[model samples]
Structures are given as structure tokens and as C-alpha cells.
Target chain A: MELVKRLLSGDMRAAARLITHIENELPDAREAIRLIYPHTGKAHVIGVTGSPGSGKSTLVDSMITEFRKKDKTVGVICVDPSSPFTGGAILGDRIRMGNHFTDKDVFIRSLATRGALGGLSKATKDAIRILDALGKDVIIVETVGTGQDEVDIVKAAHTVLVLSVPGFGDEIQIMKAGILEIADILVVNKADRDGADKLALELTLMVDLGHEEKADQKWKPLVLKTVATKNIGTPELIETIERHLQYLKSSNLLEINHKKNIEREIIELVNEHLINHLLGIMKEGDFEKLIEKIVEREIDPYSATDEILKKLYSN
Target chain B: MSYERKIRILVAKPGLDGHDRGALVLCHAFRDAGMEVIYTGILQTPEQIVETALQEDVDVVALSLLNGAHMTLFPRVRQLLIERNAEDTIVCGGGIIPEHHKPELIRQGITGLYGPGTLLDVIINHVVERVKKERWKIA
Candidate 1:
């Protein structure tokens, strides 16, 4: 509670502590979130995801610089995929954004997905809320940029920026449906490379073609190009983000998206809570017994789940 | 009670050291040990490392110094942690450190001074045990 008060007053250390608690899934984390939940819903949550080698980290680094130049306080959560073999992650994205490491106005934390296939949305959303409650003007969530399932970032943020680079081989195949569906702003990063223009054109054409149903919609997914390391086209990227935010506000899409995000958060929390609670009440080896039964084909998963649920709800 | 919390370690390459192969290896190694490793990448200052440890509330600060700045960077981190009242966070280092410098580094509160060819298990065991002992004491 003391930490929550400090976090509410914009204390960076408190914000960090709250994030650590959430990441560890500690007992007090829920209490802290409960106290700080009221102060959230103000920060603009942006999700940046793409494939490896897409320069996503450098692009996010540039975006942070752009946001800082405009005097905005930014909190960035760089989510790295946990190694399945080790449950550890090398969250090296901070190397690209270390330019802002010493800046008081900028707070960056790297989170490991912790082997969560759904990209650890539960902990990530809590970290974002803590940052939002701490009064960060813009909160950017950067993912490892893997594949379709990475779309979890979309449900967690208001604006999702999907990045891709040229010479990635078959640019058309790279701009698949999953990314185009979730992307509010599509970026062809590493734009100074060859086929930059061609890739941008392909993406623009794809965006225009895929979302034909929303022709009357004022906000179309804009495909911008950037060379992040050289800082080329970053200002334009910043402008595009601003334009999207403006459109979201004007169209009242912000409220709608916020509502959807809350619904998703509620479902995630409930799922996690129920699983943990069940595990707590179950006797030792009970779960393994159920797994064994399922493995031996003695009981189907649906029936086994129903049996467990009945036990859970019974006295 | 058995240790339950995740041991978050900040693997930092401080100073002008751009060669991060060792640091990168340690990141995955520690992670495989079921610890959360936050790689700060190369070219971090001592100040940045300490601040990251404070903010992240890491159980350990693992410094990989291939650029021979270990003497300064390691101790500076320890001192800063002390000043910040975060001495409970363990400070450790490795990479190209000469045997003679190990004593002084450990004397300054930097433990587990792993040098070249140190086994990954050696480092992991030291960290896992140290964190459990340290944290259990606090608990």
C-alpha cells in the first residue's frame, strides 16, 4: 500500500517495485494493482511487434527519442520471448534504447514472456497499468516480433504497430492477414535498404485492399517506412502515431478499444486465478493422475475438465 | 520453505565493451536455470547498471567485463548499491578478470568473480544458493 501511494505520486522506484511484484506474480501484486487501478486509463498504450531482424527494437528506440523531443514522459516494456529450454531471456532491446537510459522522464523495463505462449498478457497488462497510473504520457509495449500468436500485444494496447523490413524474401507473403488485421500503423523499417520502396508499396496496396470494408472509416492503416539506426523517417513515424491517436479520439474509438482491453484483461485474470486456485485445492498428484488418465485414453479431456470443475465448485 | 520467487538477474556489460558473446551466453544459461535474466546489452555505465538493479529489484547483478574495466565497474556498482541501501542485491562478475584482482573485488563486496572457463553450473549454483540464503534471511 505504501508502494501504491508512492507509485500514485509518480515515484519511479515504486513503479519498478510494483512491476517486479507483478512479474513475479507475488501475493502483494494484486493488492497494489487493486489500489492503483483507478489511476490508469490515461496513458496511450502502443504495441510494436514484428519478426526477428526487423529492426523493431531500433524503431522503438527512435520512437522514444521522438516522444522525448516532444516533452512526453514514456514508459517502455520490451517483452522478450523466454527460452523454452531455460525459462530465461536475453532482453537485449535495451541496448538500442540506452540513449534514454539516463533520462529521468524515460523508464524502460524488459520483461520475459516466462514461457507464456500468449506473450504473458496478464503480467504485461499489469505492468502497463502501473506505468499508466504513474502518469507516463505514452506506454510502448515491444514484443519479440515472432509470428501470428504475438497478436496478444494487440489486445493489450490501443495502437499496434507492426514492423517489417525489405529483402525479407517474398514481401507479399510477409504481409499476411494476422498482422494486417491487428496493425493500426504498419511500418517498413530498415527502409534505406534495397526494395524499400517496393516493400512499402506492396504493404500500402495490401492495406488498402484488405480493409475495403472500412472505406468510410477515417483512419486507414498507414504503412510508413523507416531506417531506425540512421534515424531516417522517424519524425514521420511519430507524426503517424499522433495522427492515429487523434483519429482514435475523434472517432471515439479510444473508449471502445479501452472497453475491449478491459474485457480481455478480466478474462485473462479470471483464467489465471481459477487455475491457481484449483491447483491450490487439489491434493498432491491429483493433476498428474488426471493427466495420466487422459494420456492412457481412459478419460477424454473435456470430461476430465468437467469432473475437475465439478469438484472445484462442490463443497 | 522452498524458494519460490524468481531470481531476477541483470546481466550487464559495462563500459566500452562491445564484445557480448559471453554476456549473451550467461543470459541464456541463467535463464535456463529458471532465473529471469535482464540483459542490459553492451556499453552500459556503472551508474546505469546500479540504477537498473535498483529499479528492476534484481536478486543479482552479474557484470560481464571483457574490456578490463572490472576493477572500477564492479566496485562502483557495489558502492552504489550500498549508497542506495540495496546491498542485499548480490553483485557478481566474470570475463577476462585476472586472478590477482579477484581478492580485492570480493573484498569490496563483489562475490562469485568468475573468470575465463568457469563452469556455468558453478555460477548458477552460487547464484541460486546465495539468493535463497539472502532472501530467506530477509523473509
Candidate 2:
């Protein structure tokens, strides 16, 4: 409880401890978060989604450096895929950004998706709230690009930067509509490569064609080129993000998007909570007779559903 | 007499290192030896790691660091465990840990320093023997 209080007061150590508790899925951790949930939602959530080896981690490291230069506190949640057999994640992304470990202003967490779809962990949304409550100025959620599921999950961010690198075979194949529609900014990283210009041009053409289809929208997606490893063009990329944030605020889309995110979070929370509760009840043998009746064909699945709903509602 | 419960262990990777094949394989070996193993996903800070070990109430905290941040990360983790009153939790480490660094790691109060090529059974036996001795002393 004292630690939870400390976490609420923006203590980095306490915040890190709380994140570990959540990652380990400790039952008491949930209660701790429930106590701190009211203090969250102030930080800007940025999602960086891209294919593996597209320099996403390097880009994140560079962006954090830029944010620090401006004296902004940043929190990064890097998601890695888990090994199904061992239920452990091979989190190697931090190797690229190890230099920032000593920065008290920066908090980096590596998460395993735990086989969750959408490239986000089941606890990721909760972890973001924890970081936001700790008063991070910018919270970056870097997802391992695993196609459409990842792109869909990143839609929660205030801004999503879809990263791509030069010489990646068939850029068109990887740039499916699921990702194309969600990217707020398109970054062609590794700009020093020979094909970088060609990739950027192709991306620009795609964005232009995309805007033509949505004529009513005023803001067009901006394409930027960068070499993430060398920290080249990263400052401009951060500026582009800031500009996008301002635009969203002035255009009043910020509130609209924030509301949608809140609605989604609440729906998901309640849905999961109710399912767990129902499962507990069922495990208590509350559904045995109903299951038996169904097995005997005394009730159809539709009737069984109605029966279960009635029992659940009566409680 | 109450049966002695199997010792639980939390094997974690702290910091931005992505090499975890060692950690995963070790978890399996521990499980096969009838131990309850909780593997914290990668890139954990020292605090996240200590907290998980406390919550799990593990008998040992075994960490695998291959990213060369072991010098900085391991000591902090050892200190945190001490602060958390988990000093009795045997802290061990393995992974491309250089032979030259083993003495320093042991000097920092790490119980054991395992390196690549160490047998799984050797680590497990050492942990079980040490934990049993500790429990016996407590009793």
C-alpha cells in the first residue's frame, strides 16, 4: 500500500515495481492499479508499430533522446513476442537503448505479448495507465510488427508512426490496408540506403492516393525520412509528432479520440471482469445441472444461454 | 511432518538484452526437476525483478544477462532484494557471463555465477541443496 501511494506520487522505483507486479499477474497488483486508475490518462500515448528489422527500436531510442533534450519525461513499453513453450519473452530491444538506463526521467518496460493477438499484452493497457499516472510526459508503446493485429492494437495511441526501411522486399505487400489506414505519420528509416528515396516516393504516392479517397478530411499524412541508428532526421520526426499533436488538439479531434479510447478501455475491462466472475460461478457447480440438461437434450443451446443469462442477472 | 514444498524460482532477464534462449531452456529444466518456475519476460528493471520475486515468494532469484549490462544491473538487483528483506533468497546468475567477471559477481553477494556450458542439472542441484540447507537451518 505504501508503494502504491509512492507510485501515485510519481516515484519511479515504485512505478517500476508496480509494473513488475502487473506483468507477473499478481492478484494484489490489480487492486493496486484500481486504486491508482483515477490518477491516469494525462500522458500522450504514442504507438510505434513496424515490421521486425525495420529499425523501430533504434527509432524509439533516438526519439527518447530527443524528448529528453526537451526535458520531457518519457516512458517506453516495448512489446516482444513470447516463446509459447516457456512463456518467456526474448526482450532484446533494450540492447540498442542501453545508454538511457541511468536517466531517472526515462522508464522503459519490456513486455511479452503472451500469445495475445494485436501484438499487445493483455496487461499492456493497464501498464500504460500505470505509466501515465506516474506522470510521464510521453508514453511510447513500441510493438513488434506482426501484421494486422499489431496495427489494429496501436489505434489506441494519440499518434501512430508506422516505420519502414529501404530495400525491404515488396513494400507494397507489407503495407496492407490495415496498416496504411492507421499510420498518422509514415517514416522511411535507414534513409542513407540507396533505395530510401524510392521507398519514400512510393509512400508519398500512396498517402496522396489515400487522401483523395477521403476528400472530406483536411489533414494529410506526412512522410519523413530518417536513419534511426545514426540519429539523423529524428529531431524532425519528433517535431512532426508535436505538430500532429497540436493539430489534433486544435481540430478538437483529441477529445473525440480520447473519449473513444476511454469507452473502449471500459468496455474491455467490464467484459473481462464479467467473464472471470461468471467462470468463477460456473466452477462452483452452478452450471452443472444446466450442462446436464443440455447433454440430455432437455434444453437447446439457445435455451441454455437464456438460462445462464437469467441466473447471472438474478445474482 | 508437513511435506517440504518444492522450491519456487524466478528466473528473469533485466534490461534490454534480447538473448533469452538460455533463460527459457533453464526454466524448462527447472520445471522438469519439479520446481515451480516463474520467468519474467525480458527487459525488466532491477525493481521489477525484485518485486516479482517477492510476490512469487521464490526460494531463489536466478537471472540471465547476456547484454553486457550485468555489471550495472546485477548489483542493484542484489541490493533491492536485501532491502525487500529477501536476503535469504539465493541469487544466482548465468549466461555469457565472462570468466573474468565471476569473482566480482560473487564479491557483490551473488550466491553463484554460472556461465555458458554449465550443465542444467548442476545448477538445479546446487539451488536445491542450498535451499534445503537454508530451510533446515531455519527449522
Candidate 3:
């Protein structure tokens, strides 16, 4: 509670401590989230995701500068890959965005996926909430796209920018329905390279064709090209992000998205709690015994689960 | 019950040093050792390093300076951390620091003024042991 109070009072130390608590899955993390939940919903959550070598980090760095030019306080949650061998991660977001290290308005933190399939830690949402409560005007969550984790991570954003470099192989794979459904803006980074125009054109045609199937779609995703390292087209990218934000507000989609996000979070929390509680009630020996029985052919897993469920409800 | 927290280290390159290969290698080393390493890339002012160490609440602040500014830069960070009442954070450095300056640097609160040829295992052990002693101290 003191941490929450200090966080609400704009203490960066307290905010960092609370984030550590969340990351470590400490006991009072739930209390901190409950206290800070009401103070959120103000920050514009933008997710930038792309394949490795797509210059997403550089793009994010450029976007941070553009956001600051508009006098907005920005918080960045950069998700980095964790070592599968050691269960550790190197958070290198600061390396790319080091110029803003001295800027008080820009607070950047790196998160390890920690083996989370969504390219984000489970505590990422709480971390975002803490920044939002601290009154950040824009919170950018950046992730490296590999699979479903990227898609899941982008769900936290109001505007999702999917970046791709030329020659990433198979434009059709890039324009899959799952990817297209999540992208509010498509970017072909490294536009100075060869095949940049071909890549952008392919993406544009895909977006246009995708829209024809969903006739009721009001917002059209704009495919843009950028050389993120050179800071080219960043202003236009920011403008497009702002436009999307405005569209969300004017159409009242912002409130709808907020509600949907909270709903998803609650369901996840419920599932987590239910499983934790059930496991807590069942002794380790009993669970292992069930496994041993299945191995010995005395009982199938289905019946073992049924028996456990019956015990769970009976007492 | 005291909860065990991850050892977070801010591996920073202060001053005009542009060679980040060593700093990045150490970042990977610390991370592989299971400590969270926040690398403050290159060309960082002392003020920026201290600020990041404070905000990140890191257990250690390791400076990697190859630009011959260790005496001026390392002490500046230690002083800032002291002024901010974060004296508990272990301050250390590596990267071409001369032997004669090691004593003064340590006297000024830098624990590990490692130079070239210091093994990653040694640095990792030093960090883990130093953090254990300081973190569990009954203040």
C-alpha cells in the first residue's frame, strides 16, 4: 500500500519497485494493481511489433522523439527475448533509445518474455498500468514478432503497427488474416533497401483486398514505408498513430476496447487463480499418484481428472 | 519471510566511448548469470547513468569506460548515487582502467575496478557475492 501511495504521488523508485514485485509475482502485486487500476485508462497504448531485423526498436526510438515533440510524456515497454537455456534475458532497449536516457519525460523499461508465449511477460499489463497511473501520456509496448506472442502482446495496444523489411520471404505469410486483423498500420521499414516498393505495393494490395471481404469496416489501415534508423517518415507515422487514436475516440471504440481489454484480463486472472487454488488443495503426493496410476494403466487421464474434479467439488 | 529478488545491474558506458562490444558482451554475461542487465549504451553522461541506476533500482552499477575518463566519470556517478541516498547500490567498473588509479577509485566507493583479462566468472562471482552481503545486511 505504501508503494501504491508513493507511485500515485509520482515516485519513480516506488514505481520501479512495484514493477519488480509484479515481475516476481509477489503476494501484494494484486493489491497494487487493484489500487492503480482506477488511475489508468488515460495513456495511449501503442504497440509496435515486427520480425527481427525489421528496425522496430529504431522506429520506436524515432517515434518517442516525435511524441516528445508534441509535449507528451512517453513510457516504453520493450520486450526482449529470454535465453531458453538460462531463463535469463538481456534487456537492450536502452542501447537503442539511449539518447532519451537523460530526458525526464521519457521513461523506458525493458521486459524479458520470460518464456511467455506472447512475447511479453504476464506482468506487462501491470507495468503499463503503473506508467499510466504515473501520468504518462503515451505508453509504447514494443515486441519482436515471431508467433502468437506478438499477436497477443499487440492486443494491449489501441493502435498496432506491424513493420516488415523487404525480402522477409513470402508476402502472403506477412499478410495472413491473423496479422492483418491486428494491424492498424503496416510499415515496410528499411525502405532504402531494394524491393522496398514491391514490398509496400504487395502490402497495400493485400490490405485493400482484405477490406473488401469486411465491407462494414470503417477504418482502413494505411501501409507506409520508413527507414527508421534515419528517422525518415517518423513524423508521418506519428501523425497516422494520432489519426487512429482520434478515430478510436470519435467512434467511441476507445471505451469499447478498454472494456474488452479488462474483460480479457479478468478472465485470465480467474483462470490463473482457479488453477492455483486447485493445485494448492491437492497434495503433491496425490497428484503424483494420479500420474503413476495413468502410467501403470490402472486409470486413464480422463477418469483421473474426473475423480479429481469430483473431489474438488465434494468438499 | 524475505523474498529473493533478481539482481539487476546497470552496465553503462559513460563519456564519449563508442566501442560498445565489451559492454554488450558483459550484458550477455550478466544476463546469462541470471541477473537482469540494463545496458545504457554508449555516450552517456554520468548524470544519466546515476539516474538510470536509481530508477531501475539496480543492485549494481557497472561502468565500462575506455575513454580514460574513469577517474572523473566513475566518481561522479558514485557521488550522485550518494547524494540521492542510494549508497547501498554497489558501484563497479571495468574497461582499461589503470592499476595505479584502482586504490583511489575503490576508496571512493567503487568495489570492482576490473581491467582487461578479468574473467567473466570472476566478475560474475564478485557481483553475486557483493550483492548478497549488502542486500542481506541488517541496517
Candidate 4:
């Protein structure tokens, strides 16, 4: 309880502890968040995503370092795949940014997907809000690059960086359309590797082709090359991001997008809270009976749904 | 009813590196061992992880890290657990944890480290034993 109070008051330890409590999905964690939910919504959210092995982590580490150089506080949320069998997060991704653990200015967290179909967790948005409320100047969300679901989650960010690397071959094809559309900036990471230029050219052509399709869309996503491992070209990448941010601000898209994000978040929170509450009230035997009826074809899912809705509405 | 309660484990990938085959496999192995596992979907801050541990009221917090950021993330989570009086929760880790970092991890309060090729059964057995010990202590 004191930790919750401290978290609301902007205590870093309490914030960190609260985040862990939420990730673990502890009951008290929900109460703590409910208590502190009113104080969130100030940090700039940046989503970085790319194909597997595209150096997204390295790029994010570089960005955090750059943000720190400016004396800005940052939070990084690294999303890793959950074990499909056990429904637990296998948090192997944190090894890339090992150097910043002690840097008071940086707070990094990892989440395992827990069988969330889209490679994004339900708790992600709330976790972001917690970090935002904790007063992080910039909050970076790094998602696993596993097709459409991941791309959709990253689009929630003010700036989305879609990363690609050489030698990925056909996986690039899978990423081309879904992730490409949302990318504010395209990064050709691992630039030291051969084919980096070729990939960049291919990406540029793809973006051009997409623009041609969109016709009057004025915003053309910028493509940049970087060797994230060595931290080369990170400064230019950051500058491009800043320029894009300025563009969004000038065009007034920032406020519009922010408002939309808030609206979507509130809807989702209410929906989640309502569903959880209803489920809690349902008796286990009642759910089992419904399942049996469905299995026995005694009731169609549509009818069953109506019945369940009636029951939920009544209570 | 002689039903065995499934050991609930929370496996978390901390930091930004995203390779997760090892974590996935471990989750499968744990499930096969009859454990109820709650995966904290990816990019969880240390706070999210601790929160999940408490909320789920899980038996263990098993983390897998290939990216070298374990040094900071692990200790911070460990410290946070202590602060929350949840230090009784067993914290074990695995994945490409470098040989040199073992001493530091153990010293910093990680209960155990499982490297590549360590059998899931072995890890499960160890966890069962550890959890039993913890329960005995509490009892």
C-alpha cells in the first residue's frame, strides 16, 4: 500500500515494483494501478519493431543512450515471445542493453507474450501508462517482429520505426506491407553486413511504390541505414525521429493521435474491467454447463452467446 | 481427491533482445511437468514482472535472458521483491547467461541459474524441492 502511494507520488522504486506486480498479474497490482491510474498520460510513446534479428534492441539501446546524453529520463518496454506451452515469458532479450541497468535515468522492462495471439500482451498499454505516469520523458516499446499483430501494436506509438536487416531474405517480404505502412522511419540495421544497401534500395522502392498507391498522402516515410551493434548512424536516426516528431506536431497530428490513443485506452480498460468482473461473478459450474451444452450441440454458439449476455446483463 | 496442484511459474524476458525459443521450450517443459504457467507478455518492466508475480501468486519467478542486460534487470527485480516482502518467492533464471556472470547473479539473490542443455525435468525437480523447502519454512 505504501508502495502504491509512493508510486503515485513518483517514487521510482515503487513504480518499478508496481510494474512487476502488474506483470505477475497480482490482484493487489490491479488495485495499485487503479489507485494511480488518474496520474498517467504525459510521456511520449515510441514503438520500435522489426523482423527478428533486425537489431531493434541495439537501436533502442542507442536511442536510450542518446536520450540520456540530453539528460532526459527514459523507459523501455521490451516485448518478447511467451512460451506457447507454459504461457510464461521467456525474457531472453534483455541481454542486449546490459550496460544501462544502473543508469538512474533509464528504466527498462520486458514482457513475455503469454500466448497473446498478436505477440502483444493485454497488459502492454497499461504498463506504458504506468511508465508514462512515473514521469518518464520518453517511453520506448520494442515489440517482437512477428507479422501483423506486432505491427498493429507498434502503430499505437507516436513514432514507429520498422527495422530490417540484410540476409533476412523472404521474411522481408512478410514484413513489407503490414509493418511498412505504419513505419514513421525505416531502419536498415546491421548496415555493416553485405546487402544492407540492397535492402535499403529495395525498401526505398517499396515505400515509393506504396506512396504511389496512396496518391495525395504527403508524408513519405524516411529510410535510414545503421549498424546498431557498433552504434553507427544512431545520431542521424535520432535526428530523423526528432524531425518527424516536429512534423507531426506542426501538422497537428500529434494531438489528434494522442486523443485517439487515450480514447482507445479508456474503452479497452472499461471493456477489460467489465469482462473480468462478469467472469468473476459467473459460477464455475454454470460455465461448465454452457460448455457441455455447446459440445453436445444442444445450443448453438450464437444462442449460447445470447443466453450468456442475458445472464451478464441481468446481474 | 488426490489432485496435485500445478506449480505456477512466471517466465519473463527482460530487456530488448527478442530471441525466445529457449523460453518457449522451457514453458512447454514446465507445462508437461504439470505446472500452471502464466507468461507475462513481452516488454515488461521490472515492475510489471513483480506485479505479475504477486497477482498470480505464483510459486516461482523464472527469467530467461540472452541479451546481456541481466546484470541490471535481475538485481533490480530481486531488490524490489525484498522491498515488497515477496522475497519468499523463488527467483531462478536461465538462457545464454554467460559463465562469468553466474557468481554475480547468485550473489545478488537469484536462487539458481540454468544454462543451455539443462534438462527441464532437472529444473522442475529443483523448483519443486525449493518450493517445498520454502513452504516448510513458512509452515
Best by DockQ: 3
Which has the better lDDT: candidate 2, or candidate 4? Answer: 2
How well is each residue in A57-113 modelled by candidate 2, as lDDT tens digits?
A: 889999999999999999988887765665544555655765576677888876666
Computed on C-alpha atoms, the DockQ of candidate 3 is 0.60
Evaluated at residue B7, the lDDT of candidate 3 is 81
What total of clashing residue pairs does each candidate reach?
3, 3, 1, 51
Model 1: runs farther than 4 Å from truth?
A171-175, A277-286, B1-4, B66-68, B98-100, B136-139
lDDT against true structure, model 1:
0.83
* Chain A fold similarity by TM-score, each prediction: 0.94, 0.88, 0.95, 0.88
Q: B1-139 in candidate 4: lDDT tens per residue?
A: 1222335678777778687788778777776665656565456678767765654456788888887788888888888888978887889887777889899899876856887888778888887788777843532
In angstroms, how far off is A149's CA in candidate 3?
5.8
lDDT of 3 at A155: 57
lDDT of each: 0.83, 0.79, 0.84, 0.75
Q: Report the C-alpha lDDT of model 1 over A1-315, residue by residue, as the tens digit.
A: 899999988898899888988877788988998898888889998999888879888988999999999999999998877777756666677778878877888889888777677554347888999999999999999977667555788778888898878887675585656765788898888888899899889888877776686767667888888889988999998888888898899999999987887797788768978888887788899999999999999999999998788878883
Candidate DockQ values, in order, are 0.59, 0.14, 0.60, 0.12
In order, the interface RMSDs are 2.2, 8.1, 2.1, 8.1
In terms of lDDT, model 3 sits at: 0.84
Model 3 clashing residue pairs (backbone): A118-A149
Tens digits of lDDT, candidate 3, B1-139: 2333678889998999898888888888998998777886788888888878866778899999888999999999999889988898899888888889899998997977777778999999988888888874633
